[model samples]
Target: MPEATPPPAAGLPELPVTWRASRTRAVLLPVAVLLVAVFCVLARAMPHNWHTNDRVALVVTGLLFAAGLLMLARPRATAGSEGVTVVNFVRTRRLDWAEIVRVNLRQGDPWAVLDLADGTTLAVVGIQPAAGRTQAVAAARALRDLVDAHATARHRR
Candidate 1:
């Protein structure tokens, strides 16, 4: 279990806190951007000897860069006073913080999972373990803190 988050002193924004996939995945956005730029530059500099297959290759490269950008978008979640949003590859889920029972990132788990009090579990694609154990654990701990703080604040009100 993680320790509690210290209360903010004053004049702090509490409505939005966003979490993303591991650093490994976060790095993809820039890399994909770079690749697209490089491909465009190379293609522009050397359009000679261009064949039908060359066009195909260019299309394929563009698609690859797009895919990389999509990969970067995978597994994102955000929290606020009201709820949390988890955006996975295919779908997105939003859950009120009060509905969440626990957040887990066990050994060998690909991503974080939120176990609801209702007994159904939802995978939080944002907090992934691929970045490294230390980082992943820290992320999980931070998430727990947010959940605890918000839930407690809600109960007190």
Candidate 2:
């Protein structure tokens, strides 16, 4: 039988901090703005026979695009000794290592759920498996390690 490699040690291992893709915002913003401007121009230049639905569609699409663009432009994640910070555009949540009960890298939206001592789950959004399998796993392991270290340190204190 061939020998198998040993698994890496547990707890938040040192990792090169990585910033998730903000490109979605970068591309969306300009397109949204341009779309809004174009719609406005079209509405003004067209004859009175223009359909109301056209105007409504333009406004709704523009609004949706603007919102998406704004979201992408902001910071997504920052990992440190204390914990990982995640920003979901509308709100921001910070999870300390001690507060996290388990680190799961499962199917669907790739996220880390922090099971706080209080029993609430804080979802960390930016760490998606769709980003890349290797990178996602590495990040998950580092986060799990962080939680382990925090728990150990607290018990020792």
Candidate 3:
């Protein structure tokens, strides 16, 4: 069993709250740099008999790999007064407050999932446990509170 979260204060959270996976960026950024460095060194060290194309290929491959890693670090979510904008690895989606029915982050889940009124779930990678368990939970809770508060306000209007 779990305790209920209190309602957020009126006009709380101020709007445009943004969440990002800092840990993901921290780890991948250095790894990408290291990878590119290694590729450059390898390119320079290729056998004298090897063609220039081979060396170029190695460096190009490394750049592509680094780009992919950086993409994984690109997920973010921003909550504004009108809606939440979720940016995942390859796509971005915007959802109005009323369109979100629930926010869930169960144990073992990779990230927070927003259950939309349309019966679809959107994974919010910006609030992932891979960043930090406590941090992820807090972020998920805050987003949920924002959704709840907005819904309540809408109903009263």
Which residue pairs show collisions in model 3?
none
Summing lDDT over every window of 10 consecutive residues in candidate 3, give the lowest-scoring window: 1-10
Query: Per-residue lDDT for 67 in model 3?
Result: 96
Which RMSD values do the candidates have, in order? 5.8, 9.1, 5.9
Sorted on lDDT, best first, the list reads 3, 1, 2
Tens-digit lDDT track for model 2 on 10-53? 44355325445334555666877887787677766777787988
Off by over 4 Å in 1: 1-15, 41-57, 153-157
Q: Write the per-residue lDDT of candidate 3 for residues 17-64, one digit (tens) a residue.
A: 899899889999999989999998999998899789999999999999
Which run of 10 residues does model 1 get worst, by summed lDDT? 1-10
Question: Between 1 and 2, whose lDDT is larger?
Answer: 1
Q: What lDDT score belongs to each candidate, Candidate 1 first? A: 0.74, 0.63, 0.88
TM-score of each: 0.70, 0.60, 0.89
